[model samples]
Target: MLILSRLRAYLRAVYCRQSFFPGPLGVFVNPFYLARSALQEAMRDSAETLNGRLLDVGCGTKPYRNLFHVSEYVGLDIDSPPARARGVADVFYAGKAFPFDPASFDAVLCNQVLEHVFNPDEFLAEIERVLKPGGKLLLTVPFAWDEHEQPWDYARYSSFGLKALLEKQGFRILNHRKLRADVSVLFQLANAYLYKLTERWPFSARLLFNATVMALFTLMGLLGARFLPDNPDLYLDHVLLAEKSA
Candidate 1:
């Protein structure tokens, strides 16, 4: 029991640091590796264009902080128990509005947060208000994901739907991408479903079971991705880069 607990803690520590871009062992142990790895690739590709006084909305642990080349990075989230426990937020705000002045930031990064926003219009408006003209907004939202973050999870958006939503908020879309547009998405979902079924098992048994399942599924997913036709229309998430018109 003690050994299993220690092992779990060690793996968790590794997961915290290498979440989106997991290490080799993490490839087998992490159930969401396929989805998260694709997200990391998209973010890394988009990180270079963002610079100076950047704001990270819903910055849970500022996981990708080192990826961006910016003069200043400020983390913001709602005042909640999870946010406090993470100890990453530089500023906390009520759900309605941000605490900063208008046109305060040169760039804004809101990753995997849009689905959780109850008032997306007001949320995007706040982002636009806080960002300087011509500043970039790098946003990622889930398109085909299970409900997460509990009761806070509200919606999912298709590629076109997301584009329309951002454009409605006066953000000019620069680049839009569909992530995990491969058979890997199917395998990932299967692995996740199985993982949930074993939730009641002992920690050691569950861990072993998940690791085996993940490994097998990941291998199959990779092979399918190599051989199958890609389906961009059916993907896991959408990553977009938009600019506030100058």
Candidate 2:
């Protein structure tokens, strides 16, 4: 049953381009999709309940609507996106800052987008301004990883750094947890290089590579979590929650 579920998951991963592992098969197994889902799940674990006007910054394809609650949902991105982002977002800003009054939103959920911001401080300030007093801010950023989106990958956050940054911008820290980086996290990353092997072999061979690497990594993590005591570095998702004063 376990193997069957994993096989199903892998097939879904491949068909969906959701991940390098098989499902979430993005433009060559993008990491953000899986990371985003993991982040959202973490947010829920931390008592996150979205309400009021919401801003999802750098919202590429705006993937969090399923979990978002709102008086409004506004998405902002750096590029001119493929879709017009109609009624869902109410409006789509061409760049980072939302064109709205201060204290306008009750919740701001920014997942996997902070590393891309050239100025995280300015971005947080914008979030502060837009969030109503005592509103919520949920964010996710990688702590350990590679240089991705080259010209963009500006910063990563340790629990302390993320907390300090948020506090400096007037947000009080409510919950901050470092993402545990297991072997699976590393394996997912390794498949990135695996794609290059496809030039030497068939696509099925590449998928085979993906399956093998992901399986190995997943096993390592499961075993590590079970045996390794008090290891902080293994958690692969950083979940942060801060609040504006009311």
Candidate 3:
């Protein structure tokens, strides 16, 4: 088991270090790059609207802190016993309501967070309440990703659905982008399924088997992305930029 753990760690290290495979291999397998890199790219692309006092909802590790030039960055999450042990947020709430007064923030960033909220409409309402008039809201949500955070993973959003929701909440949509192409989505989902299949095997064997599977799909995905047109219906995530109505 230790050997397997070491092997998995080594493979992850290699995957993180190597940004992409060479040439055309890079385009298809680009999605295989460390997940953080892709997320960082998304954040950087949308950083312009993230100025002023910012709020990070469900801020785990505040991973995109350096990407924005905000005056103050406050993090918020649900206050629960398990969450407290993780120490992942600056402020934790006991109920559905936010603690702050209305129109307190200039911008809000919510990444990979909407899916976990039991009442997305109400949650978005709170965000709108705390954001000043003309404030910006940046969000990223999964459209095609594996279940995570266990029972907490509650929803997924398509670009159209997200746009409608944001508009309904009195925010004007400025930009919406797909974080990955169809090929990347296929590769990630397949990789997830294969990884689970290997879990029952010896750790070392599972590591090697999953490694080989990942390598093969990485190449296939790269080629597909390079050769095929992106499908609008498929993507790993949707990044959105919206402005609160003045």
Q: Write the per-residue lDDT of candidate 2 for residues 1-246, one digit (tens) a residue.
A: 999788877765564545312232332333233344455557557434677778787666665565565677877655444535333344557556778788888888887788777788888899899888999988878776667767768887677778788889999887777654544455445543444545376545555654556445544544664565544765455777888877
Of models 2 and 3, which has the larger TM-score?
3
Q: What would the TM-score be for candidate 1 when compared with the true structure? A: 0.94
Judging by TM-score against the true structure, name the best candidate: 1
What TM-score goes with each of the models? 0.94, 0.75, 0.82
Residue ranges of candidate 3 with Cα displaced over 4 Å? 1-37, 199-207
After TM-score superposition, the amount by which residue 63's alpha carbon in candidate 2 deviates from its true location, in angstroms, is 2.1
Task: At residue 70, give the lDDT of candidate 2.
Answer: 66
Arrange candidates, best TM-score first.
1, 3, 2
Candidate 3 per-residue C-alpha lDDT over 134-232 given as tens digits, one digit per residue, 9 for 90 to 100:
999999898887788898888888787898889889999888888666566687677667756665877556546644666677667656778888887
Candidate 1 per-residue lDDT over residues 31-84, each given as its tens digit: 777888888889999999899999999998887899998999999999999889
> How high is the lDDT of residue 145 in model 3?
79
